[model samples]
Target: MARWKIKNVSVSGVAMAVPKNVVKTAELGLLSQEESDVFDNTVGIKSRHIAPDSMCASDMCQAAAEKLLEELGWERDSIDVLLFESVTGDYRTPPTSCVLQDRLGLSENCFSMDIPMGCCGCMYAITVAGNLLTSGNVKRALLLIGDTALRMGSMKDKSRVPLFGDCGTAVALEYDETAHDIIVDFHTYGKGYEALMTPHGGFRHPATPESFEYEDFGNGIVRAPIHTLINGMNVFSFAISRPPKSIEKFLADYNINRDTDIDYFLIHQANKMIVDRIVKKLKFPQEKVPYNLEEFGNLGGASIPSLMVTRIADQLRTKETTLLMSSFGLGLSWGTMCLKTKPMVISEIVFL
Candidate 1:
């Protein structure tokens, strides 16, 4: 059990940018009419945004960051640290964050790096950013999370392709002497690493032309070894257990009530079945837990922040809110966090 109480770190702004190319499941010929209806109702994914081949994860991240920096009216050089979290970076070398620093025109003194994580990426980024701010070594930090990898998925994979959307988010955090503490808990089960993975393009399995060879497993899902693969059953089992339990324990330890103490539960938009199961197990009210999966599908680690920007931007901008965020999947990691926002700036969801 890894837990931390971060003080004097608060979010100043948040912004999300999704590719303009909207793709509804119906748009794909792979799914039957009945299957499309089932996916829409059960998965809650009516549509998703797909980035063009020309657009990389960094492009959307840069878009959101530029807009957030502009909206917050902060000088680029004022940012002291930047972490770019994503599974599909522009390249395998020269850390993507380094390119982002140049794209955003940040100071040469700013510390920049990349964190390669999937669904758990954003929460991990935010947690790390908060801890760094605790040291008072940095005045402000930028956490950029998103993924364009789904666009790289094999088009024939009926199971995983429709479950994803491309999105990038920029969250601005600054050191504050008076802000309340941010509580976070983390857990991992590396044994399930194979539950969800892309087997090639890494040093362990360098990409080869044969990596694109197709193998149909008799199931509807087809994968080229290089494409993302998922063990849906195992992933569903993991999601329905850890996330709800961790959050329940978090609220219990903090003496916070699920009914009222927490203003909202911004969980990873994995799917309707997984999300509804977690909510029911925790006994949290449905109204307080909003879902964008119907319109945005799963944005991986970007889902939580993307949910805030796309669904509750007005509420977050108008009043102080206590947010309970939970993230799980890929790396087989799960994390739950409790954060209080003091009416920060949340920009309109940018489409590009």
Candidate 2:
């Protein structure tokens, strides 16, 4: 079997949008006087952008795609495939990709669909798009990821509300047989479905008035009656352990060590603390970990790509850089991809 190679990968364009109002951790009263005393003992957040009442995940995604198309000078009909990734959608039926396709005026023959994943979404979507391009089935593909999970009634719960922010990201991938990029691995475990999920609004339990009533779990905070319930501690522990092990497994297969090896670590922006713990355990340089959670908070599936477009693209030079990109969260799902590419400067867009 012949191995796939990335001919050329350029983030042709990128854009992002946040809610009109900025919410700071201090305003949420998340820390006590004693908890706030220590210098490093912080609530792990400064501020995050929340979407306006009228904006949905799809709307934010559309804005990003529009900007990318303009910057790349891509005609609407030139898009061969559109992949939409998000855990939050406008509806359960009719994938959001269809809505984007129509809004963008893509050709009728274009292949468009949606992938519902949490934090790991962008990595997974890129892997899938790369495969389709390498198979000679498509010439160019667009990957859009955005989420309004924060707007879900469940996010109103104090614990989650502070951790999530609404945002969208867009990346354009063109077919390139000469490119040296490879998706090393991808995997998921659904057994932990109940451990983190919206308990009352899917096939198992349709939304009902009774289901929306708050019940005390003795945690002092009232759990949302209709929102997704995530066991935060459980999710955090699972995330910190999995990605490092997965990266180690990939390195062993390739027979490479960390020191004089990988150039960058573009892990998910799930949480500042989670990223901090992984950096320490993996012994990765603190500077290599690209963290945007402090300003953008958690954009769910959009986190990694948003960081790439906003921060990573602008800093590339002409050398083969090794990047270990990983994402883990909701669905208890996670994945990591190793990318090797020559540095190319990405043009920055003035985000609104």
Candidate 3:
């Protein structure tokens, strides 16, 4: 149980970016027209924005960060820390955050690093940034989180190709003694790590010539070793079970009243079935949990922030709201974060 409360840091703004290319579920041709319709209705993903080969996750995050900084009217030199989270970075060598620091024109003294995480990454990254601010050494920080997961799947694999989207998000935070506390609860189960992963391309099993060869796994699932491999049933079970339990414990530990204490529950947009099951198990109000999976698909780490920008930006920008966000997946990890946000800038979703 890695849980703690951080004080004196407040979220100032949020922004998101996605590729301009919109790929509708019907266009994938992975399923028959009838099956595609069923997938769209049951999974709640009708379309997704996919980045081309020329675009990388860093590019989208830079776009989002730029927009957020401009809207917040903050000088780049004022940023003291920068954190970039993504499973798929621009390269295996250079840490993407360093490149972003230069790209964003932040001060040379600014602290920059990369956090390679998956679904629960945004909340985890926020916690990391919040703690840095609490140290009193950092005055302002920017959190950049997203993934180009759509590019990691084989187009022939219906189970995965249609279920992922590319997106990038930026969150601005600054140290403020008067700010509300940010509480985060984290849990990890390494035993279940294999539930979702890309087994190839890493040092453990460096990519070989055979890694690029596609294999038919039946049921319209076909992929290369280098592509993502997900045990859907295992992942579904973990998503619906562990995350809800974690959220429940978090609420009880903090003595939070879900119906009154929190204005919104921004759950990760994993899928309609998984999300619905978790919401049902927790007995959380459906209205308070907005769903953008229908339009953006599952954006991995970007799902939660994308929800703020796409679904509740207006509310978050105009009123003081208490938000509780939970995300679980990949790394067999789950987390819940509670924070208070005041009326602040939320830039329009940038399409690249």
lDDT of each: 0.90, 0.72, 0.92
Residue 155 of candidate 3: its Cα lDDT?
83
Task: Name the candidate, 1 or 2, with the larger lDDT value.
Answer: 1
Query: Which ten-residue region of model 1 has the weakest summed lDDT?
Result: 149-158
Residue-wise lDDT of candidate 2 within 81-133, one digit each (tens)? 99999878777889888888899899988898899878888877777787777
Error of 1 at 237 (Å): 0.4
State which candidate, 2 or 3, has the greater lDDT.
3
For model 3, the superposed segments whose C-alpha errors exceed 4 Å read: none
lDDT per residue, candidate 1, 1-50, as tens digits?
A: 69999999999999999889998898876798898999899999999999
Candidate 3, residues 266-348: lDDT per residue as tens digits?
A: 99999999888988999988899999999899999999999999999889989999999999988898999999998988999
The lowest-lDDT stretch of 10 consecutive residues in candidate 2 is 34-43
- State which candidate, 1 or 2, has the greater TM-score: 1
Distance from true position, residue 43, model 1, in Å? 0.7
